[model samples]
Structure formats: structure tokens, C-alpha cells
Target: MIPQGPGEEDYGALSEQRKLVLATYDLCAVCALPFRDELRWQVTFDDQLQQMGETFAFNEAPVHEVCALYAAQVCPFVSSPHARLGDAQRKGQRRAETLTLAGFTHTATVFGHDSELQVGESILMFEMADLRRIHRLTGADDARSAYEAVLRDEARIELDDAERRVVDLLCAPTPKGEDSGPVMAGAAWFIGAVFCPQIRRVQAMKKFADAEGDLYFQLAANFLDNPEMMAEWEDSNDASTAAAMSWFRTRQSVPAVLQQWRADGARRVRDVRGRRPRAVGAAVVVPRDEAAIRRRRDAEAALRKARRRKR
Candidate 1:
């Protein structure tokens, strides 16, 4: 039996009407973009249908018309910068196959952004990386074990309550074309990201700063000496300042800090002189708008003083 949306306590007890009401959300058509033509799914099940008695407990009553209720679409896939390009190229090179529910073989792709499942004999090891492909496999016990194995192995990120609720809603089984219900897709998306790996988010952030290298160190040094430059950002209302703040949220650090560090002639601990100098020269790189920073600082100081006086 097919599972309903993520929340049902027992899918098997649902009436036919309830079962028909569940919505299905497929990977394709998620964006609601118009396509030139419709796509179809092909399905085939195990030829040797043997029943293994007393070995399995069904979570949801089996549904015979699962394929008729669902369809799959293929979309263009991309890779993160942290990911090896060669691996992406190889995946792209592989012949894309169709997804069929009834088919003897199952076809799917794994992505850093998507949820993952581990497969194979290390039953319960839960980290198997290989994707299983088979021609003939059957039995309630076998199928239940396989599905349970997949769910048990599925890796998900922890999310706050609000975010997790949204994810739960998205995972709900819905009918075709009704997958994304009343909630704006954006909300659903934010929730999905909470439980998802966020591979792209990481890759995008890494691009803004030099991570894992000496360049980052050099930048950090620049910020240490010119601390005022970094602090000035808090007061500036300029578009550039706003842009900088936006970038920092994703990258999680201020570029001005690094700039100041470099200006102060800061160097790695190992590079320090045997006898440390009592003081170091400041190497400030002033842009044409240098005065704005100083003005912002003064303004803030005056504001604080005025607030204290009023109190």
C-alpha cells in the first residue's frame, strides 16, 4: 500500500475516499512552470510474487493503483562548487531512465540537496551509498524490510518547529496537479530546506570568502588593524552598506574585519617575530568615502549620549 502525506498515523485504515484525497508531490512540476508537453510514467512489478508469511507488518494497506495516481518528470540537475565537477559530469553522462512503480527495476538519482537512503546487507548500518538495481524481487517481508531500511537510513537535517511543520506538509501524499496546496510554494520551500542538506547554500556562501586557505588568514589580518571600518557598517544607510550586510549574512563574516587585519600588518602566529614588537603600524586602505565611516561613528556616539541624557 502507498503511504499518504507524512502525518497519517495509519494509512491502512483510511477509507477509499480518504485515500483518493491524498496529494502527490513529484520532483517534476514542483516549480509550476508550464511545459510544452506532458510526461508519462511506466511501471512493472516483481514477476516472482512469493509471500513470506508472518515476517512482515504492513504500515499502510497496499494500493494496486499507485502508478495510475502518480507520475514522474525529469529536470535539469546541477552540482555544488564543493562537489567535484568530474562526478557531476559522469552523472550527467549516464543515460537518464524512466521511473515506473510496477517495474522490476527502480531508477532514481541522489543529490546533495535531496534526502538520502542507504541500501544493502549491513542491515541497519544505515550508511550504504550504493543504489540498488534489480530485475526480480518480491515478498511482503522483503518489500517491508527494504522500505523500512530506506526510511531508517534516510538522512535529514534538524529544523526548528515552524520549519519542520512545513516539511511535514510537503511530504504529505497529494494527488497529481494538487501537490502544492493552499500554502504558497515559498513557505513549503523554506521548510524543505530546513530538513534538506542545503548543499547549494553552503557552496554559494563559500564563494563569497576564501575558505580553507591562507587567503582567508590574510584577509582576517587586514581587519584586525582597521576595526573602525568594520564598525562603521552598523551606522551607514548607503546601498553599498546594505549589500555588504546581505552578503555577510550568508558568508557569516564581515569583509571589513579582514581588511582591517591586513591594514594592521597582522600575520599568522608562526610568522611573528621571535621578540614580539610592542606596537605595529596600521596599514589602512582608505576609499574616497573614508569620511563616512568616521562620521557614522561620531553620530552613533552622539545618539547614545542623547539617549542617556533623555533617560
Candidate 2:
């Protein structure tokens, strides 16, 4: 099951739906429309069949299907990041898969019925947007043709200089997972630096900023120096700002935060860091050799015949 948040309990100091609004600012990650139409998901995901019981989170916000596809085409992480940074830092949850590219698996919605605990009768009530899947680009030259096949019209996705730089890295291939650890740590700087992948909503935020005149940047530029204003975002009704506030309050500059992540990741051994993921349970398994099986069966039959004769 996709992540459902801390489960049934209202978080923050707000009503349920409002808490989600605070969680994801009531907007689509791709298009920034303040409403969700379809349950959006990645085109592909790591099917760790062997680790079926383990948990995975997209750790980003929701998007329109079209937007998700658009992201699949242009967005660096969706196109394919260097690695799959799972919940290795935490206990219980298994380690994530790291690869060259993360292709689009597919996008889908949940099936549910109505009730009181689920008055809305939804498995995912308010905070579904927070339940994002992490996908990535695997190979160097792969997906480039597919990426070029589509035409993009992102006039609304306005980017400041800082954001543009990040996008540039996404489009490039130098600082990939295998080539460099630090640059490719969590597929993106904001992701690597953040405590939770769910909280690192910068990809969706590029659109969210355009929808709101880059309020986050304004807040970051202004309130980052002022403790008073920063607190207001945390306490305010503007959910996106409140979400961004979590990062600001972390106190480490984004660069420093990411750098530390890289060092820690490099220092930790792979097995010690986490287990490798191989999707299992209903997963396809290779069959044993037919001739060998027949030989074994014949031998067993001969032994049984001799034993019956002796009897």
C-alpha cells in the first residue's frame, strides 16, 4: 500500500483536510491547480519483490496524469536519477535501490468504499498528495530519444536562477550516481538534504512557486534571516509555506545539508547501510530444467519399484 501518513490521526493544529492542505498546499505538484483530479503516480517504480513486506514512498506530492507524464519526459528524477535512496536512515523500512535510471512504471488510483472512520469513504483522505513515489533515469543515453519525442509547454513553471540551476543538473549526465556520490546522492539536492523524502517537495514546488509568485523564495530570502517571520509560516494557513518552513527551520544551509548527506552515504558500507531490494511474492521465478526433472522422477520410480518387490 502507498504511504497513508501517520494514520487516521489529525496532524498539525488544523482540521483533517486542512492538515493536508498544510501538508501539500492543496495543489497538484505538476500543475499547481489547487485540486486533485486523478490519483497520480510515476510511470515506473522499484518492484523489490524480495522485500515485499518493506515500505516505499514516492515522497513527493500528487500531480495531474498529464503533468506526471510531462515530468517523466523532462524532469531529471523521473527521467532517471543516479540512485534509489530509501529509508536506510530509519529502522524497519528496508534500504532503497540505487541505479542509473528510474523509468516510469505506471500511475494508478486506489479503490475504496464509504464509511464513518472513512466518512469520505476514502483509503487516502487528505494527505494522499504527500504519498509520492521515487523514480529515476538509469542509463546514460537511454530515454533521451523518448524524452525528445515529447513537446513541453511549461510557461507556467517559472524558475528563479537557483531553481534553474537545479533543473540544469537534472538535464545533464555528468554528476550521475556511479560517477559521483555527493552530486547524485538523493537524485536532487533538496531530496538528499531533507529529513523525509515526502517533505522534499521542490519538484512540485517549482510549479507551486509560479502559482504563488515564488512566495517560498521570498520567504527563504527574507525570513531565513528573520526568526520572527519564519515562525509565521510554520503557524500560518499557507500550507506550502508551512512545508517549506520545515526545511528553513532545519538551520543547515541547503548546500551544507546536502554535503553532509553525501559524506555520510560515502562513509557507510552498502550492506551496513541497508539491504538490496528484489521484488518477490508473485514475482516471476525461473523453472527448473525439464529433462533433469524427468530423470529424477524416473530414478525415484525405479527405487520405489524395487522397494515394492522386496516387500
Candidate 3:
């Protein structure tokens, strides 16, 4: 047989590598442990998390929840809720199908794989393991904060500023006899449930809020998940999730903060309404998009990590 290059030679050797026991599996990225009862796998996804009937691992490593949270916060790549990879980073092969390190899932070793398994040339093949839960870490600051708050408050479920606002908005008496949910819409609800995720603590917050507000959103969301939370919130009120998130995100600030935003929003609305064609008006160019600015900042942070990896 003709000899191939170094990369090819390594591939051939890996394809024939002997199967090893589970004890020799890869170590946890954070703790450096070979095995654990609870493990998580970071995945880069296109349309969804579980696509093509396969699960993905970030750099082929598992991590503990504590480690993952710290990484998600400090790691620029994982912190972005809408971060994307460029063609070169993706190896320039799937240019059109740009994949992002979308999220993570709880996974473990399958039954037979514990006995024996081998790594493939460029990938590892294993049976489907239990996918206990999924965490969408993109734009995860609010969600992560809520989770950490819950963890820290072991004595009692004291509502944070955001949680308190959600409960207050939910429990307020409405024109109808029953109270209504927050004003966030379906799309906004998705952002909250999947990204910001304050609604996850609705029930616990209820212990402090009230004995009522059944038709209210945060209460109903205690039992419901993403779809159910969105539907119930929309049914109770016509507000968008953005509106709800805005309230929670800024509730701690002065109450008049939203009023100032509304004033600015009103001026923008008026400008758009009154816009007219100009004979020689060159378009007034605005600065970068919010996502672009965020990407640049994150890229700097990621570059630091890359340099560390190289060292």
C-alpha cells in the first residue's frame, strides 16, 4: 500500500486502535475525572439539539454542571446566545452549514459501551444514552443567574428583583375578575424560557407572592414548559416576551426607566412615520449591529483562550 501523509497515517492508526475499557474514557474537561455519575456534553447544532439521531460533544469532553456554568459565563464562545462560527473555524468544509456551539445536554455511557469501545478515525460511535435535560446557554446570563440564585438561597425561596417583577405583573388584578399574565409574546416567551429563563422559578416565587393569580402567567408557567408557558402567557395577555424580559431585566432600575425608553421609542416611531425622500440625502449610516459588536468583544476573549490552548 502507498504511504500517506502524517495526518492520514494518524487516521489509519486511529481507525485500527484497540477497544479499551470504560475506565480509560476521556476525562472531564473541568474536573479532569475519567468518569462520574452525572455528566454533560456540549453540542454544536444547526436546526436543533438532537438532529440526525446523534448527540455531539464539545472537543469530545464532558463537564460537571458547576464547571459548565463557570465556562459558560467566562467563555465568550459559549456565553453568546446567538454566537456563530466562521468558515475557517468550521474547517471551510461546511461553509453554507455554519454550526455554532449551540447548547448542552445531560448524557452518560450506554450499557454495552461501559464494557468496551474504541475511538474512530475522526469521531466516536456509541449507542444513544439517556438525555436527561437540555440547557440553552446562548444569552444565558439571566437564566444562569436565576439558577445560581436558587442554589444559593438554601434557607428559603426569596425572589430576586426579576422574579418579584414577574410575580407582581402576573398577580395584578385585571379588568376581568382573574389576573392576567405578563405582556410577553410567543417569540419573547421562547427567549425567556430558552434563554433568560426566569419563568422556571415561578412556583417558588409564588411561595412569597400570593395565593392567587391562577390565570396569571408566572403561576401557570410553574407547571408548564416552553410551549405551554408561551400559550398561557399569550392567552392571559397580548404582551411579547421581549416586553416581559424588559420588565424583568430593568425592574431593579428606577421605575421611570421604561418611560424614558418609551419616549425614545415614540420618537423613532414618529421619525419613521414622517420619513420622506430626499433629493441628495446620502443615507445616514448607523454604527454596527448589537450582535456584531458583541461578536467582536467575544472574539477578543476567544482569541485569548485559543492562544492559551496553543501554549
Q: Pick the candidate with the highest lDDT.
A: 3
Q: What is the C-alpha local distance difference test score of candidate 2?
A: 0.33
* Candidate 2 residue lDDT tens string, 135-226: 34444233454334423533244543323223232223332222111222222222222222222232222232353554433333233223
Model 3 TM-score relative to the real fold? 0.29
Candidate 1 whole-model C-alpha lDDT, 0 to 1 = 0.27
Residue 95, candidate 3: C-alpha displacement in angstroms: 11
> In candidate 2, which residue ranges exceed 4 Å CA deviation?
1-19, 22-26, 34-36, 43-45, 48-58, 69-311
The candidate with the higher lDDT, 1 or 2, is 2
Superposition error at 119 for model 1 (Å) = 40
Rank by TM-score, highest first. Answer: 3, 2, 1
Location of the lowest summed lDDT over 10 successive residues in candidate 3: 15-24
List the global CA lDDT of all models. Answer: 0.27, 0.33, 0.34
Q: Which numbered prediction scores highest in TM-score against the true structure?
A: 3
lDDT of 3 by residue, 1-311 (tens): 98767776444222212111111122334443332344454544345455645644222335555555555566644455455665576654432232223323333221111113223212222222455555554455744673495357423335443333333333343235332322221222232221111222222222222434423334323212222232223222333332243333333332221223233333433455464212111112233346643553454355445545756
Off by over 4 Å in 3: 1-27, 46-48, 54-59, 80-122, 125-128, 140-311
Q: Cα RMSD to native, each candidate? A: 22.2, 26.5, 24.7
**Superior candidate under TM-score, 2 versus 3:** 3
